[model samples]
Target: MLYPPHQPLQAAAIPPQRGPAGPAREDESGPWHTEAVCRRDEAGLFFAPSKEPTAARLSREEAAKRVCARCPVVIECREHALLQPEPYGVWGGLTAAERRVVLARRRRREMELKKAASAPRIAAAG
Candidate 1:
């Protein structure tokens, strides 16, 4: 019996690489990087919108927080913001007040966890 001719398989097309000009880099130490990411435009200013507002008033600070909320590198931004503990402006999707609330909550949780972890040691000593 004669064997059938082997069919050639079509190769997948590879996408062309664009030279440079990619998205902005996330710099942790650069001043502009943090400020630029948090800066609010004119529209964002003079408004105080809620996080999930339905026709709520919008303020400059709120707008700044909203913008940061959707940012790609928000986690890093938040970490930097936490380290700096900035008194004003938005960082990592959180306003100055919000950041303070988060920091407080974080500290409380850390203390709780530490206490729990040390409780066993105390019990063992007794």
Candidate 2:
């Protein structure tokens, strides 16, 4: 029996079959960062909303803080932001300035709580 010519090469030339593309479910084990699907301008800032043109015109620093208002992963983003202490851009939907403000407030609250916990209680006269 005559063997097929270049049978191995013919098999290699055939393309692998592929299934139709579909949306993937949210991955619980995967990284918590949001996907960068929004359109950005030349400065790497997200495109402004047409309805809120005034708000859209805000500086990159302010715009980032606004992102947290609507973001679903704000908590995770804030945790990552605190760990990394990123200098610029939006992380967990907060701007660099906003993060600094939040940290300061947190420290202030902690100090107040500590002071209250350590205060001596007055004894009632028998």
Candidate 3:
């Protein structure tokens, strides 16, 4: 699920890779990346090659999403992608096109909320 607009976006804070590492620090600083499955994987898996065909791109994106599915920082990654409006590759299991859709929906929802908030309410009839 996407992060709520009212709340500050926060890292998911999933458990660190097996074994004790003392208490996991709440303050993240490049530390949240230590547990990412993609760090040990190839970049090509997440990005498209030049002149890629539609079928190949689809296959590659699916593979990238699979990696993201098991990723620990998927939420944080997704938020980054959506907020940044990343124009390429897959992040948080969503392809570029998918991220566009999410961002559009979020923008519409925010607009609707703002509109409703400004509208005056009618008093109940006695």
Best by TM-score: 3
**What is the lDDT, from 0 to 100, of the residue 126 in candidate 2?**
100
Candidate 1 local Cα displacement, residue 68, angstroms? 1.4
Please give, for residues 1-126, the per-residue lDDT of candidate 1 as tens digits: 100001111211222132133333335643224333333344234234347354343355566666666666577556656766656555666767788999999999999999898875535565
TM-score of 2: 0.51
Clashing pairs in 2: none
- Which residue segments of model 3 deviate by more than 4 Å? 1-30
Best by lDDT: 3
Q: What are the lDDT figures for the candidates, one per model? A: 0.50, 0.49, 0.69
The residue-by-residue lDDT of candidate 2 on 1-126, one tens digit each, is 111111243332343222122222237643333232111213245323344465454675366456555655567656555655655556666666677898889889999999999999889999
Candidate 3 lDDT, 1-126, residue by residue in tens: 322111222433343432232233335544445555776677788888899999999999998888888888788677767765668888878899999999989899999999999999989999
Query: Candidate 3 clashing pairs?
Result: none
lDDT of candidate 1? Answer: 0.50
Each model's TM-score? Answer: 0.51, 0.51, 0.74
